[model samples]
Target: MTAQTAHAAPSTTAIATDTAGHGTRRKVLWGAQILLAAFLLIGSGLPKLVGQADAVETFDLIGWGQWFRYVTGVIEVTGAIGLLIPRLAGLAATGLIGLMAGAILTQILVIDPAWSALPAAFAIVFATIAYDRRTETRQVLRSLKR
Candidate 1:
């Protein structure tokens, strides 16, 4: 082959390098995000759902009482499941964040000010998931396109 023809094909080394770089970056990002999501889901989400645990005490302190804790627990469990499923990730983030937002506001307005820290923790976790799911959020928005 002529010199020009030889140069036309991409080098195998370059292609492999690009592919490896992309794969590694993807793995790192997915690892961090999935770990964060799982922590919030398992640590905060499931226990709240089952009601055997007493993180529900925090809600009770916020004046939600036993009945309200059960209701919030149900919503949290559903939202956690939604966060795990890719298609529903955006909605999950929104729901979880909304829940946290209400908790934060209540802590500020109705509950003791010290209790505000608890909802802030939830907000941080919810925000992390929401930021990580930006691509999914965009896909959700794009689906509304004509």
Candidate 2:
């Protein structure tokens, strides 16, 4: 390898996957987690927490009473916080996937079926993150036992 070549930036693929396949892979997952967390916290969770009119209206339609709205908001905020923590990302994603599943079902059964697709798409993203970080999740579980 020439000195000039050594100094050159690594190719995208080289930067993307290391010998253990954990280079850009982790970064991509991190980025996705951040984006999703932001959406959940700011776009969805906050409204419910603050009792925004739209959120109140939606929960009213769900017919579960306003308390359920606060419960969902707290769950979402907690999950979003977990997503930002390195060791907790996988578990957070798994939890969020379950939350999304409930959202999907509620949309289909209580609200317009058309809204279910949004949660379905989010569930897929969370699934990807959960699968990718399964090893970290296992480590977290092991640590809890010790």
TM-score of every candidate relative to the true structure: 0.57, 0.84
The true-versus-predicted C-alpha distance at residue 1 of model 1, in Å, is 37
Candidate 1 is scored at a TM of 0.57
Task: Report the C-alpha lDDT of model 2 over 49-118, residue by residue, as the tens digit.
Answer: 9999999999999999999999999989989988999889899999999999999999999999999999
Candidate 1 segments exceeding 4 Å error: 1-33, 53-56, 110-112, 121-125, 131-135, 138-146
Instruction: Give the per-residue lDDT digits (tens) of candidate 1, residues 43-97.
Output: 7666776775566667767665777776776777777677667767666877777
Supply the global lDDT for candidate 1.
0.72
Give the per-residue Cα lDDT of candidate 1 at 46.
Answer: 69
Leading candidate by TM-score: 2
TM-score of predicted structure 2: 0.84
